[model samples]
Target: MTLLAFLGVALLVVLAGSRVAFYGDALAEKRGWGRTWVGLILVAATTSLPELITGSSAAFQGLVDIAVGDVLGSTLFNLFILSLLDAVSGRVPLLGRLHPGHALALGFSLLFLALQGAALWWGGPLLGPVSWYAPAAFFLYLLAARLTFLYEKRRSLGQEERLARLYEHLEAAQVVRGYLLWGGLVVAGASFLPSLAERLAEETGLGAGFVGTAFVGAVTSLPEVVVTLSAARLGAFDLAAGNLLGSNTLLC
Candidate 1:
C-alpha cells in the first residue's frame, strides 16, 4: 500500500508538471521571454516546487540529513536525466544544441554542492543558526540567473519582435487560469511527499539520508523527468535541457 500510494502520487505530480510545462512554454512565448530564461526562472521553479517544500519542511523539523540528502540526490538525479534525453534525442547530440551559457548553471551547481559538502565537514555556522555556506550558495544562484539572462538576451536580440508575435493569439486570462489550475494540482500532489518519505523511512528501518536519496529523491523528481521528455517530444530542446539543468541548480 505504501509503495502504491507513492506511485499514485508521483503520477499526479507528473501530470500536473506536464501541464505546467505546456502553459509555461506558452506564457513565455507570449511574453517574449527567452526559452532559456523561461525554463530557468518560470518552468524550473514550478517543477522544483515539490523539492523546495519537502526540503524546507525537513529542515524546519531539524532533519538536516534528509534535507541535505534530498537536495543533493535530486541534483544528481536531474543530471542523470540528461542521459535519458541523449538516448531519445537522435543523431545530433542534445548537448550540441545547447547554448554555451549553460556552463554558468553547471558551474554554480558544482560550487553550491561543494559549499554544502564543506559545511557538513567544517561543522560551524558563520551566521546565527545559518552556516556561511548558505549565503554563498544563495548569492551564486542569483549570479547565475543574472548571467544566464544576459546571455539569453544577447542570443535572442534579433528575434524580439518575432517572439512577441508568436503567442499573440493566446489569451492572458486563459493561460493564467491554466497555470494556476495545474500549479494547484502540483501542490496537492507534492504536499504528500515529506510525510511519505518519513513513513517510508520508518517502515523500512532506513536512515534518513538513504531513504531521502534513494526513494524520496526519485519520487520527487518525477515532475522534472516528465516535463523534460514532453518538452523534447515537442522539439523544445533548449527549454527541455534548461529546465533540467535549472532544476538541478535550484535543487542544490
Candidate 2:
C-alpha cells in the first residue's frame, strides 16, 4: 500500500479506537461512576490500551526496535495531546490540585523510563522493581482508582458538582454496554495495532521510533484527542480538559 494509504488506515484506527474508549467511559458513567472516575481510570486506561498492546506485541514478535519506537511515539503523541489540552483549557492548572493518582502516575512514568534505560545499559530487555513490579504497580493503580472514585462520589454529593451544561447525543443503553464491549475491542484492536505500525514504518522508511511515536502514538491516543475536542465543542470544558490531564498522567 502507498504511504498515504497506510496513513489513512492508521487514522481510521485512531478514530475507531477513540470511539471505543468513549464507549467504555460512557459505560462507566451509566453505571453511576462520576466524571472524574470515568476520566481518570476507565477512559484513561482504555485510551492507553493501544500503546500497551502494540508495545507488547512488537516485543513478542522480536521487533524490539518497533517496540521501543512505539513507546517513544506514544510518549511524544501523548505530549501533543497534553499540549492540545493546554491550548483548549487556557491553563486550568490540573497539576495544582496535588491529586494523589496523578502524582503516583507521574512518579511511575519517570521511574519506568529511567529504569528501562538502566536496564538497557546493563544489557537487559526490561528493568527494575524485580519480578514483582508489574503486580505492585497494578496494586498501586487499583488503590489510586479506589481513592479517585471515592473523591468523585463525595464531590458529586456536595456542592462541588457542577455540570458544564454540554450534554448531547447520548444513548443510555449503548453507553451502558460500552464498558465490557469496548474493553474487549481494545484488546483485539490493540493486538493488531503494532503489527500495522510495524508494516507502516518499514514501508515508509521513516524509522521505527518516529513512525511509532507519531503514527502509533497518535493512533492509540485517538480517544482522548477526539474526546477533548468534542468536550470543548459541546461545552463540557472541564471534562474535556480533565480527560487530557488524566490521560497524560496515565501515559506518563
lDDT of each prediction vs. the true structure? 0.77, 0.56
Q: How far is candidate 1 from the true structure (C-alpha RMSD, Å)?
A: 3.1
Task: Please state the error at residue 145 of candidate 2 in Å.
Answer: 1.1
What tens-digit string does per-residue lDDT give for candidate 1 at 58-144? 899999887877788788888888788887778999888776767776777777778777888986667987778778778888988
lDDT of 2 by residue, 1-252 (tens): 555655665565455555654554454445556655676666666656667776777789989886777666676665566556545554565344223444444454565556555555665433563443445445655666676666556544332323312123556776666555645554555555555665676677754565445665565665557665654444344445445545544543
Q: Could you tell me the lDDT of residue 53 within candidate 2?
A: 73
Q: Compute each candidate's TM-score over C-alphas.
A: 0.83, 0.65
The number of the candidate with the highest lDDT is 1
Candidate 1, clashing residue pairs?
none
Model 1 local distance difference test score: 0.77
